[model samples]
Target: MKAGGGDGGSSVSDEEWERFLRASLEGVPDAPEEPSARDRAAAARRPPERAADTAWRAYTPPRRRSRKGWYVAGFVASVALLAVAFAPGGVTGLFGDDARGADAAPLAPESVAPTAPPDAGPEAVRPTLAEPFKGSPAARWADGPAGITVPEARATGWMDRAEVARALRLSRDFLVASNLEPGVLRGERPAGAIALINPRQRDVQDYLAAAFRSPGEANDPVLLFSRFDPAQARLVGDVVKTRGRLTYAEGEKGAVRVTADVTFVYPIAPAGGGDAVVRTIVRREVVMSWDDPAKVITEPGTFSLVSYRADMTNAGCGPATGRLIPSFGGGGGGTASGPAVDPYDRSTSMDERMGAAGDEECGTATRS
Candidate 1:
C-alpha cells in the first residue's frame, strides 16, 4: 500500500504508530480488580463516610446544654429525697432502737416505773399541845366547865412565871396609883385605870366608871380608895404599897387564866368629914383572851378580860366579901341597906360600906 493512497487506503505512518504506542505504555499502572460481593456488603455496612463523619464530630466541641433544664431536674431529685427522709415511718424505721448499733445501752425496766417515797404514818397527823402548858401547874385546873379545849392548848403557851408575876405587880400598882393618888378620880373617867382595862370589854369600863359614884352604886370591889364622894375626896398619905401572888392556868376559848391574891393600903379624905387609911386584901381570878402577840406588843391594851371574880377582905372594915363579874351577864347594880357603918372606916369592907350607904348610892348586888 502506498503511504499516500487516495480514498480508502490506509495512511498510518510507522513513526506515529510507534510514538502513540510508546506514549500509552510510558507511566500507566495496571487497574485494580473489582471487590467480591461479601466485601462490598461489609463495606456498605461499615460505611467509611459515617466513620469519617464521627471522627470529625469528635474533634468539634459539643453543643452547650440548657442551665434551667438541668436545675429543674436536680431540684425534682432533691425534693423526692426530702420526702423520703421526712415520711412518718421512713427515716425513723431505718435508725430506730431495733436498728441501733451494738455499742448502744439497752433501757432498764425500772426507768419506766419509778419507786415512791415512804409514808409518814399516823403520828404526823395527830395534834399536839404547846410546850408551856404541857406539864405546867395549870394542868391541875383542867377539869372545870371553862376547861381549855385541845384547840386552845395548841393556840398559845401558858404565860411565863416571871411574866405573870410582873403583870400581877404592875396591875396592883396601877390600882393603887389610879385610886389612892389625889385628883385621879376627879374626871368623868379614871384615866389611869381605864387605860389598863381592856377596851373590848365595855362592861368592865362601865363597872370601873361607876366606882367614882357614891358607895352603893359602885359594884367593882377593886376600887378601894373612895367610899364617900370620889369627886370630893383627896389623898392624905404616901403612895399605897401593894404586894401580890399570882398563878397562871389555861381557860376555854384560848384564854389565859390568872389568879392573884393582892394586898394594898388605901388612904383618903372624905368629902363630908373624916380621913381614914384602909388596909385591903383581895383574891382575884380572871380569864384573859390575848390579841396576836405582834398586835399586843404595839397596843398594850389588846387583851380582853373575859371573866373576873374578886373576893375581898378588910380586917379593919369587916368580913370577906365577894363579887363575881361574869362576862355572860350584865354588870351589878345598886342594892338595899343592911347595916349602919362609917363610910371612911378602915375596918369597913366594901360590901358593908355599900350595905350601909343606901340602894340609891351603891349599885344592886347582881351576884348571889
Candidate 2:
C-alpha cells in the first residue's frame, strides 16, 4: 500500500510537462525554415550557369548531314551551272556586257536582221582560137584559094574574130577530110564532120547525113567527089588540092555569120575516056551559134549551123571533055572586101559592090 501511494505521488505537474516540451523543441533547434512560394518563384527567375549550359546544348546546330554527300551534291551542282553558262546564247548573257538581261525588252526585227553579201562583178573576155593559130601554114593555105571571095572576119561586142576564123577552118577541114582524104573513098565515115556539126540541130544533122551517105547508084555530090565507084568514074591522080578564103560577120543575137570561097582541083577518068584535070570553085555561107563554155554536152569550138548555102562550078568535067561532069553550073568568082558591116545597126546597108560581085560569082542564093 505504501509503495502504491508513493508511485502515484511521483506523477509530473502540467507546467513541468510544458517545460519539458519547450526544452525538447529548443534542443532540437527549429527545423530549418521552408522557402516561401515567393522565394521559390524568385529563385526560378534567376538565370543559372547550369541552365545556360543546358540551353546552349539544346540550341547548338546539328552536325552537317554527311559532309561527303553534301560535297558530292555541291560538285554536281557546280558542273551543271558551268554547262549552262558556256552554251551559245548562254555565254552571251553570262560574259557580254552589252547583252540584254532576262527582264529587258526584246530587240526589234529590223535591228536584228542579217545583212546580204556583196555581189561579184562580170567575167573577163577570153582569147579565141585564132590567136594561137596566127601565121600558121594553115592560115597561109586558107588565104591561097582562088575561087569566090569571102568577107574578112570581124569581132563585135563579145564576138571573137579568132573564133570565127577557127570555125571557118574547121568547116573547111570537115569538107576536105570527108571527101578528098584518101581513105574516105573506101566507105570510111568522117569523124571530123561528125564532130563539127551539133547533133542537136536536126536540120543540119539530116543535111549532113544525106550528103555523106554511103556511095551508091545515086549521083550525090559527096559520092561524085569521093569517086567511090572507080569502074564507072574515078579521080585519076592521087594529087587533090584545096584552098579557101573566109569572111565572118556578126548575126542576130550574137551569132557568127561566115562566108567561104573555096576551090578544089583534081584529075578524073571516065569509064570510056582518058584522064583530065578538073577545077571546082565553090562558095559557102554558115551561121554559127556559140557553145556553152561551162558545159560538156557539146564539144568546145564546135558550133550549130543555123543557116547554110553552097554554090559550085567545075571545069574539065563537061560533056565535051569526056569526063565525069558535075550537074551544078560554074559561076564567076567573087572579090573579098576587108571587114564586116555593123550588125547592130540594121539600117546600115551591106557593101553593095562586094554583094553584087558575090551575086555575079555565085548566084542570088549566095547573097548574105
Candidate 3:
C-alpha cells in the first residue's frame, strides 16, 4: 500500500539558517589553536580530566578571531556539513529519506500502483465471454460438477462400508441435480433431486414444491437450486466453476449421514448476448442420511435429507429470491444492508452462519 510521489527536496531560508547556526553554537567556545605534536604529547601525558567538565573547557581557548572572520569560517564549515549530510551514502541516502536540499538529486518517483481505499471494495472489471471468471477466485476452481468431489467412504458406527458408499453417492447425485443440472439451472423443477428425498418426508416435499409454486422469503427456490430468469441472462458458457467436498459420518438412530458442502460459480451474460459476463456464487450444504430401507420405508437409491443450507452471494437482495438474478455491468437495482461477506471464504464452516437464525441480512460482497 505504499502510495504517492516523493515530497521532493527541502530548502532552508536565510533567517532559518542563521537561527540554526546561532542555536548550534550557543555554548561553543571560540575556535582554539591547533595543538602542535609536542603540545599534544604534553596533553596526553597529563592526568585524566574530570568527566563532568563542560565541553567548551576541553579545548584550551586561544585569542579569539575578529567577529567577521569567525562568522565566515563558521559559515564555510556549516556548508560542508550540509554537503556531506545530503551526499549519497550519507544520512539522507542511507535511510531512503526523500527530503534533501534543493540541489540534491531528485528522488526517483516511487512507481507505486494505485490501490482502492480501505472502505472501498475491489475495482469492478468488466468480464468477457473468453474470460467469464476473470478477476474472481472462481477462475481457479474446477468447472461444473467436476469440482464436487466425494470423499473416501468408510463404515460408520451403524452402517457397513457398502451402505456408507451408497449414502455418499446419493448426496452427490442430489447436489448435481439441484445445482449443476442443465434443466434445473434453467428454472425447471428439480424433479430428479426432489425424487431422491425420502418419500416419507411429506413436510419437506411440500415445502420444496411450494418454494417454486409460490416464491417468497420463506421458500425461495434459488436458495436450493441455481437458476436464472431466461429473459434476463444466459449462461456465458457451458461451464460453471465449483469447489467443495462431501463427508460421511454416523447420525442419530444408527444411520449414516453424508454432508455435502460446495460453492458454485455461474457466469452469465445478457440473454440477448454480447461480451459482458458476471458471476453469481451459490454455496450449498446438504445433509443426507441412510437407514435400513425396510425399517425407514426408504427405497434402494434414495436417502432422507435431514437438513440443508444455502447462501447466494452477488445475487441482488430483495423479494426476488425465488430465482438467481445476475446483475450485469452497472445493471440491476438493490441496496445491500449489512457487512460484506466473502463468498470464497470457506475457512469457517457455513453451518455456523446458517445456524444463526437472526443473522440474515442483505449486505454487500467483497467480490462476485
Candidate-wise lDDT, in order: 0.26, 0.30, 0.52
Tell how far residue 256 is off in model 2, in angstroms: 2.3
In candidate 2 the C-alpha lDDT for residue 50 amounts to 17
- The count of residue-pair clashes in candidate 1 stands at 16
> TM-score of each candidate?
0.32, 0.37, 0.63
Q: Which candidate number maximizes lDDT?
A: 3
lDDT tens digits, residues 1-368, model 2?
11101111213343453343234222122322221211101111111111111221222111100000000000000000001111111111111122111122222211111132111113211111212112111112221122223344556534577766566666555455544554443333344344554443333433333333321212133322332333333443333333444555554334454543333433333434542222233323333444433321233555545433233333212112111243212221232212221111111112221232223221211110
lDDT by residue (tens digit), candidate 1, 33-84: 2111111000111011111112212221111000000000000000000011
Model 3 regions more than 4 Å off: 1-125, 330-332, 352-355
Between candidates 2 and 3, the lDDT winner:
3
Q: After superposition, how far is residue 115 of candidate 3 from its true place, in Å?
A: 26
Off by over 4 Å in 1: 1-173, 177-182, 185-188, 205-234, 239-243, 267-301, 309-368
Instruction: Point out where model 2 deviates above 4 Å.
Output: 1-157, 161-165, 185-187, 210-228, 241-243, 271-298, 312-368
lDDT of 1: 0.26
Cα deviation in Å at residue 318, candidate 3? 1.4
